[model samples]
Target: MGQKINPLGFRLGTTQSHHSFWFAKPKDFPAELQEDERIRDSIKNYVQKNLMKVSSDFEGIIRIEIHKYKELNTTQVKIDFGRQNLLTREEEEEKDDKEEKKKLELLKTKAKIIIQLIPEPYEEPHILAEYIALQLKNRIPLGKAMQKVIELMEETDIKGIRIQIAGCIGGKERAHVQWIREGRLPLQTIRAKIKYCSYKVQTPHGVLGIKIWMFVDFVDEEFVDFVDEEFVDEEFVDEE
Candidate 1:
């Protein structure tokens, strides 16, 4: 006769063993004693004895559920890339506009001093013109030059002072020294022929003339520096 299978649910196999068995109880199994440990032990002992009755379908379900749980836990989230480039362009335009405004204000605050060359006997015209241009090129502004002259003129008590250029000989070379002076002219169209004099110094390149003029007012000295510093450009510098 075949051995009878235990129908009560049971688990078999040692904790380290790979193969195990699960069995369901028969309908005639005792109801009141179902949860008793003695009853459970009897079921486990019988299932191990009749191991061929354990189901393969239960093991397959458990394996599929474990893989599904792992897939849900490992997924990643997404971001947008063009926002940095727009911010950089805005900063560059603001810097360029500030530099242009500063240059414009500097040009508005200066006056012009016109120095005409009068040809004199015994001097080459170009020599005198070149000499005068060199002397003024790097000399400290006329304000300082005027102060020194004022002190010299006072010592001599020279009134109605006139500057005599020993060799003022230039055919058409005209030099203008401009600056910002304090007083306004009585009329905008007034023109006067103010006579001035200077000494000529010869250099390796050419002759240089230093023209001297008497200032009726010290304010004219300041006006000239302001104008030259602002309106004069590279072409004027090149003319020298």
Candidate 2:
């Protein structure tokens, strides 16, 4: 049972750190936690809506870090939002287009969003996860979808990769789990650097869950992810 814990949680103090950075009083914790979920969902929708437009160069979000301020009563979401420049150029282009803007804007009414954009070269895990989710959304078969992902990863020089899918696969009346793995994954090694992502894809059948784990190189290169924190794209969205 202990071994069944999430890999990130297992190595939190060792190789990984918290994605959300916030402190809340016991009385205020639940509301803040739900706010965090809403923020993540909004970001996910933004990525899905805009991915095809910029798929040529834009990469998937590697991770999201949320910092909440009690004094300011605001939350700042930092993601690899893959803004090679701005958080979303699509958002910029849609300015004259208010209908789409109204549809795509973050759902929060009170919290101002300060999007900090930084270029992240690490696209191993979330990219694949998004690929699988997209495939499922298009009604692709599970086996074929999983196969295509393996083929795509073969071109990369990563150490290893593992993918897991669950929840009503292939439009079945029952739900089950399936997975595919290739190369070598040193999951038990404490020093092994791995990129992980869990994603949910909605379909006509039901919602499917996907988890991807990609083993990056060892920690010798000094953990090459979100290296520069100076670059920021602060967008002040008008409260609706």
Regions of model 1 farther than 4 Å from truth: 1-138, 162-174, 177-197, 201-208, 213-240
Q: Write down the lDDT of every candidate, Cα atoms only.
A: 0.27, 0.66
User: Per model, how many backbone clashes are there?
Assistant: 23, 0
Estimate candidate 1's RMSD in Å: 51.5
Model 1 C-alpha lDDT versus the unseen true structure: 0.27
1-240: candidate 2 lDDT, tens digit per residue = 665657787666556777777788999889878877877776666665665466532346667777655555455556654444444566644522432343235433334333434344334677677777877877888889889888877777687889999998887899999999988888887677777878888888899899988887666543334323542323432221
Q: If scored against the real structure, what TM-score would every candidate get?
A: 0.18, 0.67
Q: Please, what are the lDDT tens digits per residue for candidate 1 over residues 19-76?
A: 1111225662353133223322432343234321342111110000000011122101
lDDT of 2: 0.66
Give the CA lDDT, 0 to 100, for residue 133 in model 1. Answer: 41
